[model samples]
Target: MSHPTADRARQLLDLHTQPEILVLPNVWDVVSAQVVAATPGVHALATASHSIASTFGYPDGERIPLDLHLDMVRRIVQAVSLPVSMDMESGYGHPGDTARRAIEIGVVGGNLEDGMRPLGEAVAAVQAVMDAGRAAGVDFVLNARTDAALRADPQAPRSSVIEEVITRGRAFLDAGAPVVFVPGLVARDEIQEVSDAFGPRKLTLISVPGASLPARELQALGVSRLSTGPFTQRVALTALQDAAAEIVAGGTLPAGTRPLN
Candidate 1:
């Protein structure tokens, strides 16, 4: 019989290739995971590191302990049947060790970014994740993220940043990264440029959160994945704030506001 875990990994991978764009509203905790899992046509679940950290009152950049993060991921994984991917910012520990823990909880994929570490070190970590996946017999998809174009260092020129992204993206893909994630490149033309550079490699776009470029625009640009990171959570928070203020002011609650018993 086929390995169930392997099948889950394959299922997650298959979603990335379907005709309709795979839209992942990255979730933070178990409730959010369950909510997304229960939604119609959600192919897979992903955790946004920023949102997860905030959910626990911790800052991003691995301020939360690796074990704590893993436990939360475990709960979310157990709460739903969809395959889940983690935003493992810089692995926190070695990527191989992190991958082992994540696999233990049935995660089939993860986003491993450089987190502004030395280029060589980041590349090595990516290799470690790939190796761990191989040893575990899980086709774990590692979405290798390069930050060159993420913040656009004031010191570096735009051309240089794009150049670095392509360079790192190429090296990572060559080293076995399944997806090249460039989160901060939101412009339609830039998206196209990056896609053109990567060719067959999958580009995970965290660009234009909540309809910046629209789904069709991204699909036309050859984006394999669109991660609506933490932004979705932020939108919910905004709505809640509005509803609370309305009630405090003795006004009618918003249409979707619910009271907690």
Candidate 2:
């Protein structure tokens, strides 16, 4: 049976191929989602799992229960008119079950990372997601993350790290993930090398402090998608802390606060 949201899946995938890089602000809750959705002409919305877990008093990884995570994603979907993608970290078991849960929640696509798993294991997980999608007649977008660039030993040779990421990226594409996401490879040459190596295959880069390339420049370097993981959430939390401190000192409430339905 085809998933009810199969059409949305294709639409989300098309956005990535467009000339403009698909930039997802990566919200964690209904309020953050509403703020982005309210902006005129926003393309889509994506949830940052790390932010969601932290808000729920848990750390990253699958620290939050599957049901709870799905519930939050569902709420985000209900709150936004744009397509929403869940950051399904290592997935909540196998890739098929993860795909099932994500598609069931009305999300069009998701980010599936390798985490600490072996390369082959990660590739298998991506294939499992693809298999599930086929059985269900769905075409979900799998943004595969290879952590070798981010998690490998710093003393390792740059050539080896780049090769590992490239190799895993090739495997991920073979496994049916349309986009390869390699966070922490913010250097310009490294990003270019991956882009050149993959040729037509799309690359997703994380937007972080001290990124050697800007968003548009990354686009020029062949990056198809750019997302800020949990940086925005951290900024918000810091702002909230400052506001609370003022409130405790008898200062009036901040002016831009709005109520949500």
Candidate 3:
């Protein structure tokens, strides 16, 4: 199998001819990465940080150490032939440390979020990370995430949500982030509004099972990219549970469920 090259990732980002948004199914491991890469038109692979952390018996909130996370990135990169982007939650440290380690492991892209930092400080962190990538000769696609909706109360005003995301997104872009990811955005009109507000700027929309609109529909609204973001991992876990329950209930294995070697 072919391995992902830096040039391939750069080419993927340079294509801005259409309103067609790239759908990136989040993968937790080498097997999932290979499965997603086998699907047609899946030009890139994105790592779900939550999924990765959970697999290692850790929670999603920066629980996994940086060395282990980079090791996982290296393994996934070796396993798949498509460009791999990682969900580098809060950069796992200060911006420079995270970005340097990410590029060192051959990750072509990653997401950094403005979690607890002030907006300006977050931008500066991201800028340091981008500089680290450039110094390593990797053209990293940094998709900065603004987590206002996830943190704020559900009853928060829509205007407050919009204002925070736009403010953070602008700073990230100015600091060299190629794309801005807004998680927890659900409504079609809201997605369109964000897309319109960031015209010519790349925007990444994340989908949760019931919280967000469908991926194809979001693409139609001009989103630059779509990610499942730990949803697929949950689906896999649910399936395993159901299968185990069936066995415990004296149900026989379905025919052709196992392959012959």
Candidate 4:
């Protein structure tokens, strides 16, 4: 019989190839995972490293210790039957080991950022994570990320940034990552350019506030996934802030509020 983790890994990979775009609302903890999983039409769950770190009072970029991060991830993995992919920011400088540990904790896939590292080094990091997954008998879905657009020079031409994203994205795909996540390029033309470069259902993008296109339009452009990275957490916090302000003004809690945890 196939292992459950391996099965889940395959399921996540398959989601990327389907005609519809896989939309993931990134989660931070067990409760968030449970809530998203319980929602109709959610096929998978992804963790936002930023959200997780902030919940623990730390900043993002892997500021939280690996063990603590893994512990929280384990709780989330156990909380839902859906495939869980972790945002392993730069792999804590040990891509292989980190991937292996995450796999052991039942995480079927992950996002590993290149952080604009040297091409060779970033390719090796992608390989390391995939190698770890292969050794563990799971077809890990590595959403290899390129920060080219995120770090692009404002004075540089937009075409140059698109080219950089395509270059890094192809390299990561060749390094065994099933999909390449290119964040920060929200314009329709830019997204279409990168999506065309990567071919059908192989490009993933982060959905931030004011994204130009809806999920269906992105799917029409051949983008495979649109994940809300840390935005969900921000939205939740905004609601809390609004409610707290109302309470201080002598208002009771919101009428429609109910228990989710």
- Each model's lDDT comes to 0.84, 0.85, 0.80, 0.94
- Summing lDDT over every window of 10 consecutive residues in candidate 4, give the lowest-scoring window: 206-215
Best by TM-score: 4
Clashing pairs in 1: none
Q: Can you write out model 4's per-residue Cα lDDT over 117-232, one digit (the tens) per residue? A: 99999999999999999999999999999999999999999988899999999999998999999888799888888988988888998887875478888999999999999999
User: Residue 196 of candidate 2: its Cα lDDT?
Assistant: 88
- Supply candidate 3's per-residue lDDT for 127: 88
Identify the leading candidate in terms of lDDT: 4
In candidate 1, what residue range of length 10 has the lowest lDDT sum? 252-261
**For candidate 4, what is the TM-score?**
0.98
lDDT of 3 by residue, 24-70 (tens): 88998888888889888888899998999999999988899878887
lDDT agreement of model 2 with the native? 0.85
Q: Name the candidate, 1 or 3, with the larger TM-score value.
A: 1
Candidate 3: segments with Cα more than 4 A from true spot: 1-4, 15-18, 254-261
Each prediction's TM-score against the native? 0.94, 0.92, 0.92, 0.98
Candidate 3's TM-score reads 0.92
